[model samples]
Target: MPGMPKPIRLLSSQLVDQIAAGEVVERPASVAKELIENSLDAGARRIEIDLEQGGVKLLRIRDDGHGIPVEELALALARHATSKIGGLADLEAVASLGFRGEALPSIASVSRLTLTSRAAGAERAWQVRVDGEGRVGEPQPAAHPTGTTVEVRDLFFNVPARRKFLRTEKTELGHLEQVVQRMALVRPDVALRLTHAGRGLLDLPAAADPPGIERRLEALLGAAFLEHALRLDAAAVGLRLHGWLVRPAFSRSQADRQFFFVNGRAVRDRLVTHAVRQAFQDVLHQARHPAYLLYLELPAGLVDVNVHPAKHEVRFREGRQVHDFIFRTLQRRLAEGGLAGTEAEPGAPSPTIDQRPLVGGAPPPAGTPRQAAMPLRLGDERAGYRFSFAAQRPPAARADAAPPPVAEESTAEGGALPPLGLAIGQLSGIYVLAQAEDGLVIVDMHAAHERIGYERLKAAWAAGRVTSQPLLVPVVVAVSAAEVALVETHQALLQGLGLAVDPLGRDRVAVRAIPALLQGADAERLLRDLLADLAVHGDAGRIAAEIDRVLATLACHRAVRAHHRLGLEEMNALLRDMERTARADQCNHGRPTWVRLTQQDLDRLFSRGR
Candidate 1:
């Protein structure tokens, strides 16, 4: 019994390296990610890439950075041999992206690899080679500049099975280009040149300033991104978040435009995704995706960068804190600046306003559209905003809605104009038309009221925790086994959302209680939907979002419906509310609540500006 067979033995260096290659080199994209990261970490301001046959036959990367020294050329290919990290301390707070030093060796073990490098002020450049068997070649003098060149050939040649699993040429190139694109986005100051099969794919110059960076973004992400993007700069505690968030009105059908970097390294972390997704939850529709290029900076010690071999995933020491910070920061930006946040262009024609003289301060003649309207006035711009009663009330009352009448406030001469302008008349019984300082303001009555109502509902709900009612008879919903487990495991989180979910059987959950607001609602369907959201997004962070959806549903029902005729006072009242409501530009569904067309735009449409 004491003599157990020993299976432990030292694996050959080649075999051990091949095993590392298995995890580090999945395909051409994997190879590109590691190589580009190394170039960036070396302080390279410019990088050049060339690939052929989808990088299966050849992959070459050259960088203008401090390269490997002649003496260290051979050592560069050895596993775990790196000048990046010296000890456990350096490992704890890795500042460079290539501290692990596994990329070179792991790649060499799977492909024919060569590295030629010359550090700054070196007498001459040097080159080292490694074959598929992981055998290192002696260093030799090579003609080169103050930079590095790495060439990989015949990827996965040693393992025919792995080579066979690669996708088609176009598919692989797409993945490889995505890798380059992601890296290119992260380092705007770095000039990157990419070529595939001798054809130039991407040529981007280095940007040294913010405007230049914006130009680069426009080129890469497209002009739409710049037109719709809102610059975000916010810091709290020890974390700083700064970048561009596309307006919700410009959400994408797919998530291809979302690029997030943690301390300059591009990452796809769940905590970050969850936080951003949650922030845009209410504003964006279910099928739509928010587009953003967000960058976060914090002390390295608070984050673990070595969690994934590819470095695409990171572990934040304070996950919930980071999540909350990201959510609150982005949420605040969206609230402060509604859709189309930019102001009117400079050097435009001086505004021309029309005024209607009032006799006896009488109410505007019924059914007679007025030529004058009040422009948007400055007020408290925070989320908890409300309009002055004077902006809504008139000298006389309207049966449609009730507000105290005011005689002096009827004319723009009495006070400042409102930001949304004063409503002139309703169009097609749907849109409320208004005249602003420099342009025309068109408001969708239903969408405007829906957002205003939704905000109020949320404010009221936040004032007091959600009210829940116990179901007299528990409603059992049929669900998959996993859903049942979800309800059982997250019982506390569900309870926090005013849902008491208990597993009924192998594939069912009994909802014993639901939020009071959703009492008469379909409890079974809501529970099932909540379970589905949890499965896809994970955790209690999205539970509040579930509550928001229910609120939005209620708000939609109570909001003014299209085709509902309204008096001039009623229209003005809605406009006044929109000027102060949170996220007033868009409804709960992310559809724009209002739109503006400058006077010049109208002139152009009618060829009056020619």
Candidate 2:
């Protein structure tokens, strides 16, 4: 054969596997992933991982599962070869967590790799060594329990360029922990252990039941999740989805805990995330993401898993159908109160929808404040939104609360510093439409109440003059020891807010009295949520936020019920209160309490005189 070009010759199978390693094994965390998957596929019930310097010098995975035979060690290091599947047809219904089969060879090509395995009945264990360049040392006999231990040392030694891109050791280890967590979440039945430099990092026992599984998740994520979550199950188009999603009232700054699994494989698909947010539209604020764990069970033939080398992303045969299902199901679930929706009991008052005020309304009522014509933007990218003259008012230039605190507080100084205008009427029995100096103001009765309650609680607590009412029945709150610690730390703070809770046991607390504001409220449910927040944030400052949150809910419950035909006098008083209230122009949560525009807006819209 004619001599090939040097560059072309160098790009052989050996180099190809090395190149694949770039994507599959980006850092020590990547190596940890490949090794852990091997352990899981072996049917190991208990898996332990130990790392050092982000596994740059040492990465070890020990699992109790069927080990490799001594003779097959060399073939295991060959590129593109794996015991995971036999041929192309096997790819259709892949049940094993680890596929692709290139993980071992890729690592072996770029790092010093060692594998030790012992069959269940074998008396002696065997070890295999593969150095960079895919060279293998002899398989030597050794002693070990039935299982396998795979170690990769000097990761990226053969690829200096890749090593340079690696992050700090702490960062690399954090990634490793993330992989371990994702795996642990899906496989709750498996006992998972992780250590760094001989120090125990995480040790989670196997979960024997669903509750146990959820408890494990709570521990890993946060105990607050236990209460914030609601179970959702939906089946459509031969696809079944079952999981837990956070209530609209409960959210995080980021969407890190959103887990989606197809069949048994964890994957990230944009359609699902988008559908979730769409379902939660208008419920969550723009930057706040909810937490969810969703599992999808459908025919394997419908999905194409060969789209990416890492297999984290997948293509659906019926992508739109899946998207629609996710959207509708989540929307339905959220509508059921997990998000935001109104409900009334039989014989209870039904909400009266106000059409005129919500859409194009008569020009500003005569004798109203002089408002600037401020334009309002609405609508979304998918479903175009429109804004008509709905109660346009003058624009009073002002902002709501200073940049919100990372955590909520019952009392935000100067929160109610200024009033916007007068409350006119409610829209659809939910939004309180009020009039301001420059524009119309809308307030979420619930959010406004919450802000008022928060401020009240903070003042009382700061003054050490909290008013508590003894519950007709004392309440018992079940929480974890960690939460108990949080409560003890904030005992004085909570007491000052008129809540008296004493730790009765390791994972339980006794509630003696609650804040007078919550006299008729669901004390049990409220305390449970409080403990959940404490467990999640682990910060005393979060208590202040919780107080505000509770107050908001209370306000929603206490505020003039939607559908209540307001007397003109009451409406005028509401408007006057809003005008004198700080943040009157906006709701407590930053949503505009009202929006206004002048006659000029109509002129501009009609282009009568530019």
Candidate 3:
């Protein structure tokens, strides 16, 4: 008797529905999401939601969409009955928000559901009722407009286990409000209203233009986010991405402000998250998350949205392509804007720099500010004091040569001034103060120089100018079979990053050469870290990031120290270089290099505005 096996049996239809409900209907918020998506799929332009007791007791949704006919009212409550798709081919390319058809039957199995609808040209409305026992009632005559209204009461009434899991009224309401907010953000052309316990919570009108969308964003995400956000619209191949990205300075400690939508459906994808993190890694502080509202659109056939019952995750056919595209687009945008472009105050004019060469050129046409000749040397042995701008300045100039004379440009009449203005003086031998057209500019000399040097080094490394240093004896390191395979597969990529690694055996690798710039570093540790990154992301970004980190450290040490004294000419040269460098707003360690104090801010500080 103890060794006997139990007989196999098929679950009842009602029990099967309830089991499916466990996946699709997790809570009241889940119910709201399904119903709202259904309304949108029905081409509803105006929808209203009413809830009581956080939707555990009563939940009602009314939509001005073409509803079902009386003859189909009974079938709508049946299992596997859907008008959204027909065959397997339609399943592969599902464009609608919902198509599984399980939402109604599954929901009906766990609660009381009433469906009322009136066709476009029907003489009257029809209503059908279903309970948690899977019993359906016949369609009956009802008084209603030319639309549909779904009323669900006593959620999980029969399934006490599931009902017990529901949280308090306030917590459930919060989750439900988030669902409504996500829906409202995606469809700017749809008007949505939400009321809880007879109290109006939200009313969003349809937005028709860009300005209207901006107003909606402000209302939803707050004015501060919109103020520091950059509008992005990029398209390539068959994929299109558009959204707003907040600058790194305004990043949040938590990821609650990020919203990503794919083909009008809110989803969470690891590929997308990795790409965003890679793009902002160099600029954001540790543990800080970038805030964004990004929308990605591609052909539905290229993505599989049917993998999950909740439809909150999707699988991309070409995940690597998507990742690279996202990373490149954001990286280019950040570089092109530089510091002045994104860090300007909301109402302040963006500072512009003079396009004239800053080093070794003919004199300017009469009245402009004279460009200083300050060359920095950053060779391997010169990690103490001497910095090099050899990449920027002409090769003929020496590192220790004195800079040329500075001809002060008059701002009183008609002279042009760069965006960062002219360096007025130094503060504590650390900060370089400058006077601009609208206000004052403060620059941290050490941080600013570190960023400038780091960018140049990265450019040099990317251009294949960084040579590799061969070890006297190859360093052998033990690793897993997967790590060895990674090394073999990415041999060429590793070579490009100045890391020469080859599989020594089934579970080991030999590192023969490292980046000449990082000659004395630990090759074994670096290779292990790189293998870990490759195992996770399946890309060369980790190796590159590792090299960049070492390069950043070198630049930080070689950069001018805080206590170093400099004349106005030297400070002005540093300021001009910052204007041309990418990501100059923050140093390699994600600290701001400069800040601006507007005249209004100064007036407020002095109580003059009062």
How far off is residue 311 in model 2, in Å?
1.2
Per-residue alpha-carbon lDDT of candidate 1 for residues 154-273, written as tens digits (9 for 90 to 100): 999998988989999999999999888888788888999999899999999998776677678767876556655566677899999877777676687889989999988889998899
Q: List the residue pairs that clash in candidate 3.
A: 376-387, 376-388, 376-389, 377-387, 377-388, 378-388
Model 2 local distance difference test score: 0.65
**How would you encode candidate 2's per-residue C-alpha lDDT over 1-610 as one tens digit per residue?**
9887666345677788888887688788778777787888889999999888888988989999988877787777777777777876778766676778788888888889898899877778999898787678999998879999988898888888888998899998988898888888878889999999999999999997665776687678765554445566778889987777665554567778788888877898876676676666545666777778888888877887777787788888887788778878876654443112133233322211111121121223332322221221111121221212223233341222111112222111333211233444456555565544334545555454443443444445566665788887788888888878877888986787678889988998888898775567676676766666455433233344445556556554665654554433445445434433322332334343443433444455557674
RMSD of each: 8.8, 24.5, 9.3
Off by over 4 Å in 1: 1-8, 339-417, 474-512, 520-543
Error of 1 at 113 (Å): 1.2
Quick one: best TM-score, which candidate?
3
Clashing residue pair totals per candidate (backbone < 3 A): 6, 34, 6
Candidate with the larger lDDT of 1 and 2: 1
TM-score of 1: 0.82
Question: What ordering of candidates by TM-score runs from best to worst?
Answer: 3, 1, 2
Per-residue accuracy of model 3 over 1-610 as CA lDDT, tens digit each: 4987989999999999999999999999999999999999988999999999999999999998988899998888888899999999999999999999999899999999999999889999999999679999988999999889999999999999999999999999999999999998899889999999999999889987766777777677766566556656778989988787766655777898889999999999988998998988777776888888889999999889998999999999888898888888787655544343333334322223221211222322322221111122112122122222222223453433323224444242245445666766677778888777656777889999998999888887787765899999999999999888888888888888788888877988899999887788889988888887788778867667767787788889889998676766688789778877887766876666776665665666677846
